[model samples]
Structure formats: structure tokens, C-alpha cells
Target: MSSPRKTSPGKRMTAGLLVMAGLLLVREFAPESPIAIAALIIGLIALLIIIPAYFRALLSSRRDR
Candidate 1:
């Protein structure tokens, strides 16, 4: 049996930020459209989820050192 690879939270956070940036760029092209609104909501939710996890992971890693 193989152990699953662990992904660090910072990397996850970076990916989430990249996705949010992409969504923002897309939204700029269609500022009042439904798709833009949905993208904004999704990006906000992603930041809400990932930012906390990243901070928690950062603190835990420091304690392990």
C-alpha cells in the first residue's frame, strides 16, 4: 500500500489565490453579468476557506520546528 502525498496548506492557498485572480480578470470583462456575480461569490468563499487553513497550517509547522 502506498501512502498518499500530503499537500502543504500554503500551496493550496496559492492555488486558491490564483483562481480568485483569474475570476477577477474574467469579471472585469463582464462586470454586471450573472457569471461574474457567481464567480465573485465563489472566489470570496474560497478565500474564506483557504486563508484560515493556511494560517493554521503555518502555526502548526512553526510549533513542530
Candidate 2:
């Protein structure tokens, strides 16, 4: 049997996606609410943060091999 490996970036990206989905649902119910806008902004920020972090990890791992 083989153990499965975990990835931090993958998890972060998945979390970002889930947050965005939740924000979309909120927007559908209350499009003009401040809370919906706030949730959207936070979700975008989380998604943006993951991009560079993922690339950096990929580049560093390549250099090691």
C-alpha cells in the first residue's frame, strides 16, 4: 500500500475556490450587500496569493533536481 502525499498549494487553491463559490451564492441572494462584496474581495485575494506561491515552489523544486 502507498501513502498519499499532501500539497499545501493545492489545498490553498481549493479553499480559494470554495470561498469564491460561497461568495457567489451570497451575491445571488443579496447582490448589494457589503458582506457579499467583502466576501468576494477576500476570495479574490486568496486566489491571487496562491498563484505566485505555487509557481515559486515549482521553480525551486526544479532547481533541486
Candidate 3:
């Protein structure tokens, strides 16, 4: 039997970013909803924060290899 593989942090962050992007797309059709507005705000903030961190981690990890 094969053991379950562990997911790396970078991959987890990518999934999160993809989800956030999906929410942003959904927000386009429901711009009047307060919840969607809040989600857009939160998602933008997360993208701003996570994108930089993801790139830095990716670069550092590659350098370590």
C-alpha cells in the first residue's frame, strides 16, 4: 500500500488563490450583494498578500534545491 502524500504549502496557497479568483468571478454577476462585496474585498486583500509570499517561497525553495 502506498502512503498518502503530503501537500506542500505552495500548492495549498495556489488552491486558495484559485478559490478566491472564482469568488471574484462570481461577484461580477452579483455585484449588489453585500456578501459578494465583502468577499471581493477579502479576496483582493488575500491575493495581494499571498501572491508576493507565494513567489518568495517558491524562489527560496527552488534555491534550496
Candidate 4:
């Protein structure tokens, strides 16, 4: 039997750190730039859309189990 593949906590942490670093570099290059503002707004919008879906999925999965 094969086990399910899973991401380790360390891998998740590293990926998060890399993403944060990239965002910091972008901000450093263009502090107060329109692209940065737009990026921020888009990210906020994505979060607003995704978070509700994420919670719904979590609740549904829990209910299934």
C-alpha cells in the first residue's frame, strides 16, 4: 500500500519565507508605486474571495468525515 503524499511543515515555512522575501524586494524597488498599490489591492481581493471558499471547504470536509 502507498501512503498519501504530504508537504512537511518545514517546506511550507520555506515557501512562505521565499514569497515574503520576494514581496519585500518588490516593495523596496518601488515604495509607494502604483504597481505596488495595485498589487496590494489585488492581493486583498484574492484573499477576500479565497478565504470564504477555504472555510467552506474546511467545513464541508469536516462534515463529510
Candidate 5:
């Protein structure tokens, strides 16, 4: 008998939310300063990369089950 698969919805949601929050924080902190803008850009890049990866992993895990 195979064990039931685990769906980490909470983890996925938390990660996505955290990344979004970080992005918001970066934007709010340095809306005009060049360094803040750079950080915001970097945060956006990271968010673009991370959120999808997290969702993909979550979906793959669910599919595997």
C-alpha cells in the first residue's frame, strides 16, 4: 500500500506571500533612492524566479501523489 501524498499548501502560500511582502517592503523603503530602486529591482527578479518555482514544485508534488 502506498502512503498518501502530502500537499504543502501552507508552505507554498507562505513562501509566495513572503516574497511578495519583501518586494513590497523594498519598493516602499526606497521608492526614490537609486539603491532602494536597485534593491527593489533585485527583489522583483527574485520574486519572479521564486514564486513560479514554488508553485511548480507544489504542483509537481501533488501530481506525483
Candidate 6:
């Protein structure tokens, strides 16, 4: 059996912010389009995943130190 690799908290947060920026840009540039709504939904999902993953990594790293 092999253990899964850990992801860096910083990376997750960076990705989340980037997704948010992309979503915002899409919405700003094309508010009447369907893609903007899709971006918003995807961005929210990315944020939901990122926040918890980032915290989990942060706490575990602290615990190990």
C-alpha cells in the first residue's frame, strides 16, 4: 500500500484565487453569457475545495512541526 502525496496549502490558495479572478473576469466581460454563470459555479466549487484543503494542510504541517 502507498500513501497519497500531500499538496501544499499555498498552492491550493493560489489556485483558488486564480479561479476567482478568472470567474470575475468572465462575468465582468460577459455578464449576459452562460459561460459567466458556469464560471461562477465552478469558482464556488474550487473555493469550497481549496479552503478546507488549505486548512487541513496547514494544521497537519503545524502538528508535525
TM-score of each: 0.78, 0.59, 0.57, 0.52, 0.49, 0.73
lDDT of 6 by residue, 1-65 (tens): 99998767777888888888889999999999999889989988988978897888789889999
lDDT tens digits by residue: candidate 3, 37-61: 7888888877876777687778879
List where candidate 1 sits over 4 angstroms from the true fold: none
- Shift in Å, residue 39, candidate 6: 0.7
Ranking 2 against 4 by TM-score, winner: 2
Most accurate candidate by TM-score: 1
| lDDT (10s digit) by residue, model 2, range 1-65 | 99998666657666767777887888889888898889778877977967766776688678879
Residue-level lDDT of model 1, residues 1-65, one tens digit each, is: 99999878887888888888999997999998999989989999889868887997889899999
> Which structure is stronger by lDDT: 3 or 6?
6
Q: Which ten residues in a row have the lowest lDDT in candidate 4?
A: 8-17
Worst 10 residues of 1 by lDDT: 6-15
Worst 10 residues of 2 by lDDT: 6-15
50 in model 3: Cα distance from truth in Å? 2.5
Q: In model 1, what lDDT does residue 2 have?
A: 100
Q: After superposition on all CA atoms, how large is the RMSD of candidate 4? A: 6.6
Q: What would the per-residue lDDT of candidate 4 be over residues 23-58, giving only the tens digit for each residue?
A: 566677887898777656655555554556556656
lDDT (CA) per prediction? 0.87, 0.76, 0.79, 0.61, 0.71, 0.87
Clashes of each: 0, 0, 0, 0, 0, 0
Those runs of model 5 whose alpha carbons end farther than 4 Å from true positions after fitting are: 1-32
Alpha carbon deviation, residue 44, candidate 2 (Å)? 2.0
